[model samples]
Target: MAANESADGSLRAPEDFRSSTCGDTKSLKKSHLACRGAVAIAAISLITAIILSSILFAIWGAAREEDPTFQNKQTENLQQCQKQCEDLKMMLHLATQDSRCRLCPEGWLWWRRHCYFFSVGLQENRRWKESAEFCQEHNSSLVEIKDDAEMDFLQGVMCNATKFPFLWVGLTDSQQEGRWLWLSGKDIQDHLPLVVQWDSDDRDCADLRGDGTLFAADCEEYGPWACKRES
Candidate 1:
């Protein structure tokens, strides 16, 4: 008979006693007021806690739901920053190192103290051996990627070129079957620390892709090749 409904649709019992003598009535009224005050404070605190928690959860959820385009833009920015850093390091190197340090020849790219020239606009693309000969004519050799940095650079640059998909490097297994060699006549395994991850273990020629990966190609594929020299 002394129940009350709270705003949250919960039933609660009033702390006031109905059966009280006149002398005890004032004390009961005082107790009732104190209990009501405590209940009000508790209700306000619970509602405040729920509101704060809801806001925090909404913020966390939105943070986790990142926009795909925004993520792509962030990736592009990171790549550009990396490229700028590399360029700065190259400038400092040219400033501090031997005077012989210089810009790559026309149509060439400079990376890690090496000059790379990607062949293009030829009357016709040459065979693997002829491509090597072309590099030899320039006092360089068909490019041999030496590290991950070099691989990434070559892949990125090629991706921007008008002509691409595959390009040649100074790698072959001509003299002996299954034993690879660089154009420099050194055993491929001995000269390069990384393994030649061939598309198949049976092919001889080496080709680089715009995606910065390697695959074995037919020795006579008509495509541009890269040349490399010390800078």
Candidate 2:
């Protein structure tokens, strides 16, 4: 009976030791699992921050691109408004013309309540001032340049005539060389017609060349000339 009791006590001690070791292993495994979960949560937070930063950067870039486009559209709208205002003023002037006007003479083209005459057959080429006097003989003056399109239209009319090789245009620097003043006393140096053949420095006078274009000419030379009048 004593031998049996001793063997049973030894077996019980070994069994108790195995149970304590198993409990320690289970505690270590639980700690490892908790550490892995913490690491995974940190990684997920880092990814979310990166995604938000990318979205913000894209929004800022898109706003920068749109700014210039919006300003360009606004400028276009302002220009259109200015053009409409000018057209309205012209229409009002036209409406008032009937109360104070009569028919223009023959051989004269009527435009903007004024009459323009082209003396194509006149043979005498005179100085610009002399041409102005010739037009005054018929109660008129030298042609006045109103705008770019009007000047271009006058150039086209002069070009059509084959009979007059050249004419004295009402543009000259006789009063002040290199400084052209129109008959209306408006500074025409800036608005002087473009010369197809530019002259040397000594040629200060202006005349319409044979090609139906304006050029500097000798004041004493003779050529056909243009005249203008108001209706």
Candidate 3:
């Protein structure tokens, strides 16, 4: 009749059995609570670790950016890039100003990497030495014809400038009696002797006629002259 009694009618203590069952339930509850507590602690530790790692990373990044050496290096790189850009712009401007591949300046003729300027009036004309000095003042020298193409160009430009028989140029045999040399101290060896149409008599200076012919003449002759320099 007791709640703890079995079918065989053996004597049983209901309070002691109830107490034992309650003890087992308490053990189960404690195990469940311990498991939940351990899981919560693990979750909290992981979150703390993540937050600490993020803080450390942020600190390191900020410190690195604020470092004097790093900042100086970045500034130096930026300045170097700006300097290179400025150099490029200057080079472009100079190239536009020079370089016979492009147009020549006002009142100057461009031909094969050289710029030619002809004196306009009789007052502007000078003797061979004076003309050489004039060209040197402009940072150039009296014109030197290296080949037939150059000769033709010189003659064409001179023809447009004047109809004179002999236009003074850079060639002269003053240094040696027979050997002609340019004002730049270069020998006139490239042009053949037959190509040089000097007068039968010997003279110190040379000139380019309107017909693209070269003739030996007096060095003191006053006339218009051409100046030449690289692009």
Candidate 4:
């Protein structure tokens, strides 16, 4: 009976050792599961952080694009540059025009793209036809009053150059009665301001009075004259 009892006690001791081994295995498994869970949480946190960062960056870029002050500043800079370029071009054009105007003849005067010569101190006065011939000899023609601007220039130049009473121009009604014509074949009534004083008869040539008006006169009348040509 004592031997049998000892064997039973040894068998019970083996069962207790198996139970302890099982408990250790269970604890190791639980620790492994907890470690796996922590790793998964870290991975999820990293992914979420990356997503949030990307979202913030996109919002910042959008805000910058919508900034009105920044856009307006860029536009203002562009407009200022354009205006400066236009001013430079205008300056160049004016310089070129001035240079061209300086190429007029020494004894002539430059006005509005034409060179004018007023017969100021001629030894002898010329008749209307003789004045026309004289101007033609000089590679020009008798002055033809065109627009108000040219008339103004002629008056100003004549007043400054000479004290002559009347100057013969290229206006005449000799071609047809009562129909005035310029030397260029253009009708005077069509091209120029009709500030002419007509006579009843025996008047075919035109003369510019000191008052800046035209007067019909005889072709044989002698007076100082003006000539005009391209500059």
Candidate 5:
């Protein structure tokens, strides 16, 4: 009887030890899971903070780009308006001069120490060489444009004149086509009178239609012209 009791007691003690070991292992596992959850939460919070900061920075940059004073639409519009006003003023001056100059009906316009004339009403249309002679007969040669105001004035005058009749002008490519030479013997700059219908390469002489601007035409064509002399 005593030996049986001892064996039973020893088996009970071993079972109790195993239960305690199992309980300790479960507690350790629960602590490890809690630590992992805390680490994950910290990582998520850091990422969210970074994302929010980036969004704020982007919004600030966009606002700066849209600033009104630095990128003002009104300023651009005002500049365009000013330029148009200047052009209109110049046109008005030319129109007034055109009307006043007609009363004189002289060889050239004497203004600001210069002479200007549109030769479209001359008696005959001749080659460029012949037109030069005709101008010489009047103690003047073909007209020369000296400055921007003069060119603008001439453009405005020609635009106002009748379109079909041709006038002789001072500019010609007599020396070389595409290389315009004025009566002043200087290369014609880009600022000279430009007609809508330019002459072909073979047509070196410049003539003005009744419209007042100069155009290139065949030297033999009968047309009016412009002549100028120093005032």
Candidate 6:
């Protein structure tokens, strides 16, 4: 028998036996390479998972360390905001009280540092002298215009108030012709003379027209009036 033949007397070819042994060897090598590749992949995956878990744990640890400080800062800011709001509320309450104490009386208009009353809706028209008495009854006086500013304010008020022809003011030349004087006994300054349209007739009293013009009217003429007093 040849060295490659089976012991039972069956003949075996050397070429065929060699071919089968080479095929089995190649399959074993392929299986070993596949198993090595799978092991390498599993190792890489495990390493990646460990690295990610370590990063996550580090971030969580740092956040935990800062949590109390962040919470305290937030609470401090909230408390400051609440304190500021309380201060503003207190200031507003005090200001309201102060304003109420200084407010003008009912039926009176406050301007600058004085209170004023317009007689448009109060009573029937009165003569210039009667108008002065009516203002006295209210503990006020016929409005004594201090400057052009006061005159302008009064004119604006009259312009917006009513359609009455004119309102009596505290100005007159009844004591002497050609010599005008305010109710306060201050001589009408020549420099302060506004566009006074004097009457051709012998008129003494001055009235404010809705057009903001001053007209010399007779003292006996009946008209509404304005009064003024300190606030």
Best by lDDT: 4
lDDT of 4 by residue, 1-231 (tens): 001223333222233322322224345446545555555554555555556556555555566477857556655554554555555555545544442224344456778777776765532566788779867765679998778888888877767755767788998888787888999998887765575587546899888977788888888866778889765
Looking at model 1, residue 231 earns an lDDT score of 48
Which candidate number maximizes TM-score? Answer: 6
lDDT of 6 by residue, 191-226 (tens): 366545775446888888777677888877677788
Over 133-158, each residue of candidate 2 has an lDDT whose tens digit, in order, gives: 76776566777666776676666776
Model 3 spans with C-alpha error above 4 angstroms: 1-105, 161-164, 191-202
* Model 3 agreement with the true structure over 33-113: per-residue lDDT tens digits: 555555555455555555655655555557665786865555555565455555555554554443222333344566886
Whole-model lDDT values for every prediction? 0.61, 0.54, 0.60, 0.66, 0.55, 0.65
Residues forming the 10-long window of minimal summed lDDT in candidate 5:
1-10
RMSD of each: 36.9, 47.8, 46.9, 49.5, 46.0, 48.0
Candidate 1 C-alpha lDDT tens digits along 108-188: 677887778776543246677777876776557898776678878888877787676678898777667666677767776
How accurate locally is residue 217 in candidate 4, as Cα lDDT from 0 to 100? Answer: 87
Residue 108 Cα positional deviation in candidate 1, in Å, after optimal superposition: 1.8
Judge candidate 2 at residue 78 and give its lDDT. Answer: 47
lDDT of 4 at 67: 85
lDDT of 6: 0.65
How does model 1 fare in lDDT? Answer: 0.61
Which residue runs does candidate 1 get wrong by more than 4 Å? Answer: 1-102, 190-203
How are the candidates ranked when ordered by TM-score, highest leading? 6, 4, 3, 1, 2, 5
Alpha-carbon deviation at 197 in model 3, angstroms = 4.7
Worst 10-residue lDDT window, candidate 1: 13-22
Indicate the residue-level lDDT of 207 in model 3: 75
For candidate 1, what is the TM-score? 0.49
